[model samples]
Target: MVAGDRILMHLQGRSALVVGGTSGVGEATAERLVAEGCTVVITGRDVVKGRAAAQRIGAVFCRADVRDVDAMIAAVDTAADLGAMGVLVHCAGVGHAARTIGRDCAYSSAHSLDDFRETIDINLVGTFNAVRLAASAIARTDPDELGQRGAIVLTSSLAAMVGQTGQAAYAASKAGQLGLLLPLARDLSSKGIRVNAVVPGGMDTAIYGPEGPSEALRRAVSDAAIFPKRMGRPAEFASLVVELLRNDYINASAVELAAGTVQLPR
Candidate 1:
């Protein structure tokens, strides 16, 4: 909040819509956005968890599935009723585990075609749908006093650049997200919208399943040779997304948070 500090958001009384705001990095970013003075509308398919996060942050919960275009548009409609959606953050994505061959079968599993398609549909296409829907609404709004037209923050993964033994589906989807930044930024340029993606490393949050945080992922991570020797925190991811929310200087790019640990093809 200091003048010299890096946070650049002018979020007071503005509105932001965070997709997949029920948990993990999504929930963390929603909290940070709220704290930065943006009235937040958080969405997810899990009504219970979504409502909980919204209530906890003093925001509203909108039921939405990013993979469904209608639902994504509905989320924007809900934002319209609230206020100008000055920021849009898409954090809904699936982290998958699949291998093409059996080289790592002892520590891997093959994905069915259904699983592969679902991963692609939800992770890549879902992100694109959310951005299109939200950016359309944001483009209609007048610029802020700062002549800014809002930012779209997409979430990618380090796996997009360097996949491990069993991350074919996940890596492909995340890499697709990385690939969309340039085109999306160009397409939305005339509208004054900025598009960016965050390629965060593994973070410590409960985004795995209904089972809560995964000890198995933690074990695998420890067993593996990560440079930092530990998982990243959700707050760290949120911090970067918050910076992206108000930054006009950062556009058409993806930021990585891997701590130089993801060079190998593992």
Candidate 2:
């Protein structure tokens, strides 16, 4: 059976807000949430893709960048208005492809500070923005019989732990997610909120578009895996997110879904 078909109705009567749910893992997770009988809201900067994805999943589309505090609050409110807010999956982020130093003749072309800042703003800071606002709204609601009010799943990357060349900024931003997982879980535990992170390995997503990585690079990466010798499917990532939501005992953990692939110098 497909990933959507396998989802348990654990999310019935609850609501989920997927920040960056327009495509890839985010879109897959949104679809799974809907399959599990949750009212879902998805947010993204791309109106065309966001609306289309939401329509496909029968979810509400909120056009908001995760970096904007007011916009994130509004997105959270949209989900809460649907039902008791219980799930938040943050998947809005960008990839950094530029190297810390350019390979030009003079070697004067270094990665701009602005570029580094932008990566952190969108990936790290934006995630924190969504988490804080969403958790606040969730905390106001009463916990379930299991004493759990909400679950948050943040997307980290394998780069956070073992990044390849040209991934300094990307890896740092993802590592910042790891930094947030434990503390946020502890801080929100008193309110019956659970926070966790997923460090996904190379996945075949829009993040690496048709023009992104070469076929050889992709194959070599797949060959390095311990098993499941291929790029991960978005559904695989989504399945884990759903499991984390229903299993309350899985708080403050950073789960890796890379099939044991390791990073080598590019």
Candidate 3:
């Protein structure tokens, strides 16, 4: 078959599990997957919002926390039951902002260890949880004529490379995901499962809150972009995610979605 034909066949009738699909980039990705003719199951911790988002996008909702092993396995099983499990997109993560030292310069004013651990557990460990469980299901699926069984796309952040002040925990966790990409792709190669990551920068999403980010804050971030001079849209993020999952040769790659912007310390 021609390469174009192979790419077109990858999504149709396939089953995809998208972690953090209740909102933001994950919701957008799930919607795009459905439009591409894939059966998608989205997972989130909130039952109401999860169900609502699933309904809005014509996807199935599974209430599951990214950090929970059993919960993620159940989500994978749910997707597998929908069709041949072939896609896993992990978009779940938390952002934290706390400096290593407080302005008071007191020893007691150090960054909260609990907060750092929670961020790492949810962002880094949760990514592994989703990838490992989903890969197992995808590996079981019969490989295609091109020896491709499935694809996995992980959502990372440019902060991993250029974190601002007070973003140590968030940056470290996202960096961990990037660290996992290559080894994960290698380990899953024999099973015909590809792993890749998207490093987005300053996307306009709910992470900024329902009312959106303050004008000053938004302008500060947008000003750093080399061109377009605006934050990225979730749909733009979704587009890259779909491409990564469809393009079989993009394994282990970390594509930055920043508009030529290199974040600097505040």
Candidate 4:
């Protein structure tokens, strides 16, 4: 049976919001949430893709950029309007590949400061923005019998812990997410909300490009895995996400979904 076939007891009739749900891991997670009986709202910057994804998964589409405060707030409001907001999965982020100093080692060949800033803004700052706003909406809802109000799951990358060459910006941004998980969970403890993160490695997603990763690149990354020797499926990642949301005991933690792969090739 697929993830959608199982309706999680805790999530039934609850509402959820998935940022960057137009495709990839976000889309997969949103689909699973619908299966678990959530009133789901998905947000993306592209209207056409966002609408199509939402329609495909039985979710509402909201066009919102993660970096924009007004847009994120509007997206949260849209989810809250459907029902009590109980789950938030932030999957919106970008990867950058530029060495601090180019191979030429010339001043003109240095990495662009603007690129680094953009990655941090969207991946790190945007995460905090969405979490804060969505947590507020969730806190407003009455807690469950267990005194649990809601749960949040953030998508962090394996690069955060073991960054490969040209991954400085991406790694730092994801690491920043780890920095937020524990503190945010602590801050929301009184409100009965939990925060956690999924650190995925080499997932099969569109981040590779429209054509996907080349065979050589795929094998290189897959070889890094300890078992099954392949990149992770988006559905597999989605499963962990729902599990984290369902298991109340698991909080303020970062779970790695890398098949025991701890290091990345340079």
Tell me, by lDDT, which candidate is best.
3
For each of the candidates, the C-alpha root-mean-square deviation to the true structure, in angstroms, is: 4.0, 4.3, 1.4, 3.8
Clashes of each: 0, 0, 0, 0
Q: Can you write out model 1's per-residue Cα lDDT over 1-266, one digit (the tens) per residue?
A: 44445335466777899998878888999999889888888999989888888888788898988887787888888886788777898999877775675655643444577888999999999988898889999998887545567888999988888887778899999999989999999998887788888888767776666675578776555444357776778888899998876775888989987655544455
Query: Between which residue pairs do clashes occur in model 2?
Result: none
Better of 1 and 3 by TM-score: 3
Arrange candidates, best lDDT first.
Answer: 3, 4, 2, 1
Candidate lDDT values, in order: 0.82, 0.89, 0.92, 0.91
For residue 209, what is the lDDT in candidate 4? 88
Mark the regions of model 3 whose C-alpha exceeds 4 Å error after superposition.
1-9
Q: In model 4, where is the ten-residue run with the lowest total lDDT? A: 1-10
TM-score of 2: 0.93
Off by over 4 Å in 1: 1-9, 102-110, 209-228, 263-266
Q: Stretches of candidate 4 above 4 Å error?
A: 1-9
- My TM-score estimates for the predictions, one after another, are 0.88, 0.93, 0.97, 0.96
What is the descending TM-score order?
A: 3, 4, 2, 1
Write candidate 2's Cα lDDT for 1-266 as tens digits.
55334432257989899999999999999999999989999999989988999989899999999888888888999999999998999999999877887778345688888999999999999999999999998898887665678899999999999988899999999999999999999999999898988899988887977475568867977987889888889999999999888875788999999999977776
Backbone steric clashes in candidate 4, count: 0
